[model samples]
Target: MTQQPHLFCFGLGYTALALARVLKQQGWRVTGTCRSTSNTEEARALGLEIVIFDPDHPVEGLAQRLAGVTHLLSSVPPGAAGDPVLQAHGATLAEAAPRLKWIGYLSTTGVYGDRQGGWVDEQSPLTPSGERGQRRLDAETAWLALPQPAHLFRLAGIYGPGRSVLDTIRAGKARRVLKPGQVFSRIHRDDIVQILLASFAHPNPGAAYNACDDDAADPAEVTAYACKLLNVAPPPEVPFAEAALSPMARSFYDDNKRVRNDRIKRELGVTLKYPDYRAGLTALLATESATSSSTTA
Candidate 1:
């Protein structure tokens, strides 16, 4: 008898929930771990069986949970203690890994560090400017060293649905920050799922891929475009030097690089649903319109 597809996500964040939704529709069994009981409630609303799992504080029954898991994906970020998933439950996963088809670790393009606004592929050097990026690099290494097939998806700025510049604009927090020659790569959340789904069909273990849209664009342009979509005037551009951002926020601007998504295309054959910010924002605005009308009606 052929085994059924089962996905066990370590952290059921926004992205994981989206993937679970599609997999459930495709007749796959899905289960996941969330940080808190409150998030577990939200996961249940998505029709997923979720357990309270805070890797920082250890939990039991992880071994039992791994029993029937055929595939695994971890979206959990690393911390000072390193990867919470590996530190807490690496042994159980290693035991279950041989039979598993694929394991994907959602890493950050920050792992590539500051590339002087240049371009980086999957094989770029891992020299992160901050401790957070270093931790992710460590986590990626640990996951890949596992005896199972593991794929690393180094993702750029992720935006979609309620988390895009559109939301920021509507919430009265939008800023047109201008730093000349500073371009950042962003990927739509839906496109991220599609890339993963495509990889699932191909199943290349020990492979690393960069996940980002074709357009590596200026933030000011994105801000102006969002305002255009909403029929609002764009905010005045604030030069990056005068923005007075927090250290964490400033750290983001330290790294500048355009990511190449050719591997996902050449290897997994993915054609991004939103190839650029313009396409993504237009589609999201349309969805917002339809959803608002339906809810009001």
Candidate 2:
């Protein structure tokens, strides 16, 4: 009998869960860690095993459960003390994960930081302009240093169902905060999931790929497009200085760089379902409408 693939995710959040759904269709056994089991009823219904996990609070006997794992992926961000998974179990995974073939660390494009709205590829300099970017860069380095074929995916802004500009506009909170020459790159959630699966199909140890769409567009442009689709007026433009945004939200505008995703296409031989926000938003709207219709019926 042929052994089936088993994937263990360190943080089963949006991106990881999306990948898990795809892998499940291929007869893969999926298990992951989350902050709480209480919120995992939906995940459990999908045949996933979710364990309560927090960096500050380690789960006992997790090491014993990692046998026969064929792949590992982490969507957990690094905290003040560094990446929670690597810091806690890097050594053990390296030594004991006998079946492990590929390991992936989900990183951010912020590590290339504030390129004056210029373009950045995988070979771009690691000059992060913010703490979040810097921490991700450090985490990328540490994960690569492990005794394994650890790959890094530096992702752009992630947006998808229940989390896109559509949701913001529906809640009447969509604002086109103006920051001149500030362009941002983004990836749909499903695209990120596809990239994860593609990497598994073609493993290149110590490789770094920028995961984003074909276009690096302006925030206002995307909002206007979403509003157009919904037949609602786009929120009036607000200057960045005048906009009432939290520190963290404001910090997003701090970095301005267009990420290039040539590597994923070149190496992984993958094509993106949503090449830009226009395609992604249209699909999300359709998906929402379908779900709404099903629920009402």
Candidate 3:
């Protein structure tokens, strides 16, 4: 009897949840770790197997849980002490590397740091500007060092479904922050899932791919587009310097670059479903409206 495909994700966050849901629908056994009991319950409600895990709270018997897991994906970000998964289960993973077909580590475009609106691809020098970016870069190195070849996905800003700017606007917190010569690369969550699925089809270990859309536009442009889709007036624009953004939110402005995703297309044979903010926001609005109609019916 042929063995079924089984995917084990290190962290069942937004992106991982999306990928796991798709794989589960296609008959793959999916299991992963969340950070909290509430998230575990919510994920289980969606027919996913999730256990709580973190740096201090490691999952017991992770090795036994991961038995027969053909594919592995880690979306956990490194903390001050480093990657929680590796810190806790590196030995087990190294021991199991021989049987695992593929391992993917979800990194960030922040590893590329600020580029002054310049473009960067997979070959770009990693010069992360902050402590968070540095942590991600370090974690990528650790994952690649494992005996099992690991694929690194440097993802740009992710938004989709209930997580996009549409939610921000509806919640009355949308803002158009203008920064001269500043641009950000963003990928819709669905596009990220497609890239992951494509990579699974074309398994190339020791490969690093930039996961983002072809369009790199300003935040203000994306916000304006989302407002247009919602049929609401765009909020007054605020200069980046005076936006009064929280320290964490303000940190996002430290990077300015157009991330090139040609590698995923050229090597993995992948195409983006929503190539730009306009298309993504439009589709999100349509989906939300359809869901609302169904609920009302």
- Which candidate should be chosen as best, given lDDT against the real structure? 3
Those runs of model 2 whose alpha carbons end farther than 4 Å from true positions after fitting are: 97-99, 294-297
lDDT of 3 by residue, 41-72 (tens): 65786687787788888888888988889999
- Which candidate model has the greater TM-score, 2 or 3? 3
Q: 1 or 3: which has the higher lDDT? A: 3
TM-score of each: 0.97, 0.96, 0.97
List runs of model 3 lying over 4 Å from the truth: none
All candidates in order of lDDT, best leading: 3, 1, 2
Candidate 3 residue-pair clash tally: 0
> 82-141 in candidate 1: lDDT tens per residue?
999889888888888888888999999999999888999998788998899999999999
Give per-residue CA lDDT, model 2, range 89-151, as digits (tens): 877777754457889999999899898889899997899998888999999998888777589
Candidate 1: count the clashes: 0
